[model samples]
Target: MAHRRPATGRVSTLSEAKASSRAARSRQLCRSRRKAVSCSGAAARQSCSRATWTWSDYALEEAGRLTHPLRYDAETDHFVPIAWDEAFERAGAALRSVADPNQVEFYTSGRASNEAAFLYQLFAREFGTNNFPDCSNMCHEATSVGLPKSIGVGKGTVTLEDFDETDAVFSFGHNPGTNHPRMLGTLREVSRRGKPIIAINPLRERGLERFQDPQAPVEMVTLGATPISSAYHLIKVGGDLALLKGMMKALFEADALDMAAGGAGLLDREFIHMHTSGIDALRADIDATDWDAICRVSGLSRDAIESIARGYWTAPRAIFCYGMGITQHRHGTETVQQMANLLLLRGNFGREGAGICPVRGHSNVQGDRTVGITEIPTEHFLERLDRAFGITSPRAHGHNAVEAIAAMRDGTAKAFIGLGGNLAVAISDPQTTFPAFRKLDLSVQIVTKLNRTCLLTARESLVLPCLGRTEIDVQASGRQAVTVEDSMSVVHASRGMLKPVSDTLRSEPAIVAGLARAAVPNSVVAWDELVADYDRIRDKIEEVFPDFYDFNERVRVKGGFRLRVGASQRQWDTPDGLAHFLVTELPLDVEREGHPYLLTTIRSHDQYNTTIYGLNDRYRGITGRRDVVFLNADDLRELGLEHGDRVDIVAGERELRGQTAVAHDIARGSIAAYYPEANGLIALDEHDHASGTPSYKSTPVRVRRAA
Candidate 1:
């Protein structure tokens, strides 16, 4: 069981003694695992286990605090500390140098707050461009693009309360323990009730198998781990589309036999006729999908696929949950629609404990989009913004992450302003992106800690330090609390309790206000007044998005409030005012000749996105290194290789050499490696045409002996 220091405010002397004793035991355990007798004292380790290290551990122990603003010196090829005024001046000049606002791209990270994101888009539109390349383009763009076409909303409809009554949960392509630890408690309770949890993924994660809650003292101290999944299915890379179709086919076949016997069918006929359209086309497409092809592509027997279908049929209420694994594919958007189709088949919308749940990562990614941080903005949102701020906003569509990178590569984009994320490393094809970034005339990074992206210097780069979520944010108005929307669309306030790491650190809102004032001086929006109090910002947001009426008051309530979703009420906002079942064609390029192995990039357990906490992945049983690839032992035997053999991977024109291959329980013909490092294997152009999301989960690669 993993040990975490409980946030019990202050500790007593007894608490300190217990913590010291626990720390000593932890250090001894680590030493025993490594078979070393010598010790390095208590300064060598933190409170958590080797796998789970808190953010403070990373900031204090790994990467030191970034306390001042920095600028890149071209002559010296290094970063030097500079004044905030000078950094903003350089950033503003670069923004002004571009003759066309379309040539300047603004990127945002998911960690930013609602107030910051709203101001960012307002500034961009006022500056005469909409080139908003955000982190969502690389992660959940499929959900944003597909769900709107199918159910008239892009977010999940179920709330936390719905979990109590849920009969079954179908989890796909996400590891809750590492990615979203908070969800493990919910799943742990759900599992204790003996509800069925069907897990589908290429890798058999330890978290999904068992979890010991640190919050529960007995569970942690007694080593009582609760079982999470009732059954775990290993799907092949890029095989979700076939597997989903197979489940629906089995259900449809069962319904047909029931109807022939003069009995009521499994499907909701009245709901289908009244609330949905294009069923005939969808049915025909599903019927046309051959079982043999489904079995071959999905790497599952017919019986296994039907067994999953049986769970879906038996459950009166079910919630289908998925993550990036379902979205990071060439046909990711279509795959999302299929999941919606399955839910709609049973009239799951607007019902208790039932809906499509796309579990989002990051703290407020959903809220950021809700507040209008998108490349493609609707005309209604633009018109409202123009009316509210009395500014003529840009009506042209903007570049997504992929397009923004290409623009930088071709020298079309002159400047890049990042709000929070490590954009280059987070996106695919770093080999091309790294060079493209160097060609940029200006690059600005608003961050709290040093990262690989901060080090990637441009002609004129600025690394501006900002207050993190854990620090108090004080502006002209007074102390402030920013709001973040969860994966379930619950908007809540997050107040910082700890003091600032550095007195020089500024809030994201203050930083954006400074940039906006210098960049676009003529804009009529009261940038300073908006930043004075977050209530005024919420008011402006409410003015633009009427769905958030009484935003100031509603956000103050406990657990906050939920944004208006038409599909949650069974009110389809599609073109025909009805949910449509989309007919999709399976991707033809799923399998490649010679490139028999499909390599997927994954994050280590000790890392969050691109922020490496330590050189370890305890759940996967890896330590002290990330330059290794996980492969099935049978695949190694077939290739005439051993577990620790050195290999070079080739994907299309990109190559990653000398990666150590480790035998694991991953699917046959599939391989996994730590991300950002393996990002070079993914090509820039290889992405979903509809969503522009890179195929990060399934890149066809050839592994050979490293000569």
Candidate 2:
């Protein structure tokens, strides 16, 4: 793909000239590397390093564009091209066949724009069902569930500007280089400015260690990679709860010591007394937690815990940023609360550079929820939506992603309509999930490209290809732009610049409008009119969601506007009108005596969620294969296994056979494997009790040498 950069002048800036030279040298290096490596299959592409063009990237460029809708023929076990009219006719007929609206489930991906998501949930509500199972339920549901109870909001309060003033940044359970590449640039600047960065994860990620931004010519050409993490801790999988508690225990001791010496306490006593509640209970819990148990469970020494506490205690402003590692667990909600608790102890909220940041997985996952794609809708939101659309929205709570899967398995749900996601592959226990798709009466996917989810094939399955993010979307009102909310509370308009890959493909809003018109022929809302102009959709959205009062006008601005974050302004929207601290228990129930190893599923450098861009995990030095399991050298010795040995991973009643094991720098007694492939080992039932988010980060397993 050609990069969109500004034109250089005859006499270029020193930085620009350096960047140009580095870019030229990088291209030369790629050509030389191409001669030495073979980029053929998808697996090979996945294993190829980022500098080299992988087979999958080449395939996408080489293969002609897909320009038609497909219908799955179960009898022939193949996908056959079908006209748009036939595809919609069959999908509409299937929806009509459903005896009750509750039998149909609408699953949405984070990739869907705000315009599309708003229309989708609105249509589902009009159809008289709240069965909105979304992508957030699987990833950051913990943040959504826990942060609201703590800070009165689900989103990260800090913006891109906040990072500039932060004294310290705590990174927990996330890899910035691959998951969010743009973040690496911010981290590079932070490091250069002499701020302390503490990285906490089971594996020592390369991105956290050092970074060389190609966009900066001097850094890339001079090999002057900025060092990131000042302190790195390898906390055990499922040990975040223990680690957090240990840090708090250390902080309490420090506070007491300082107070006895006629000095102010380490904690912000004013913030706790004025803005928060339940500190006594939290203090009692921390006092009761034994240091020996904390060390054993966290896999960190008491001294190390104290050092972590000292860093936070000394920093004027610190930001706690976490990813799926903290959320994809049995006690994901509690873990999130603990992070919030740590931040609140230091008066992090309402500050310019300090806040709890949940690094979201997708670009617009937060936006989807903000625009009302939730199973559990607020009464106020429902009332407003009802008032705006002249229809009574459902009050009863509906199924989340996990519950949706169970609903399908038990035949409670018959029809499934996916709005831009590979639900089957991304979900756990594919052994049962794949068969559940077959049992569905109808399955329809709105996608930009073919994926495994489309091939699962229900009795009547239709694949309606849609316009991608890079393509221009032309509606009845000519060109249109869609809005998306980033991880922070900022909402902005996204206008596609490239031409459409195919004229047959439609925008997400157009397809959703088509389905809505067919599914509810006599609907009170004008579906066609809404799609005609996206501005009208934003107007309706403002009517339903009060936060976006001047949605259309404000969104047209260059940088857009930020939603009202109460916690950011020292205003809490809780029942007591104050932030609250909650006490949490450790996840001792997740421990298994029989299974000595804790397995965490991770994504490769070449992949984004389930989308495979190549075969290489360049940062981790992984190349040419995705079947290797990362293990500690000592653990390998104890298990009587060596590097290159084939092993079978057994978790509960399921087993993944013939995976090669390689010794690495991961925590002892914990193993790491690729996601989706390792997802089969995670049971559908094993999830956080509070959030219903799958425990993908910490699964107890036993490894055996495969014959």
Off by over 4 Å in 2: 1-65
Candidate 1 segments whose C-alpha is farther than 4 A from its true place? 1-61
Which tens-of-lDDT digit does each residue in 23-96 have in candidate 2? 45545544543322222233223212222222232233222334567776555444556788788889888998
Count of clashing pairs, candidate 2: 9
Candidate 1 C-alpha error for residue 495, in Å: 1.1
lDDT of each: 0.83, 0.84
The residue-by-residue lDDT of candidate 1 on 408-498, one tens digit each, is: 9999998999999989888999888988988988888898765666656777888888989878988778989899999988888988989
TM-score of each: 0.91, 0.91
Deviation in Å, model 1, residue 479 alpha carbon: 0.7
Decoy 1 TM-score against native: 0.91
Model 1 poorest ten-residue lDDT run: 35-44
> Residue 121 in candidate 2 has what lDDT?
97
Worst 10 residues of 2 by lDDT: 2-11
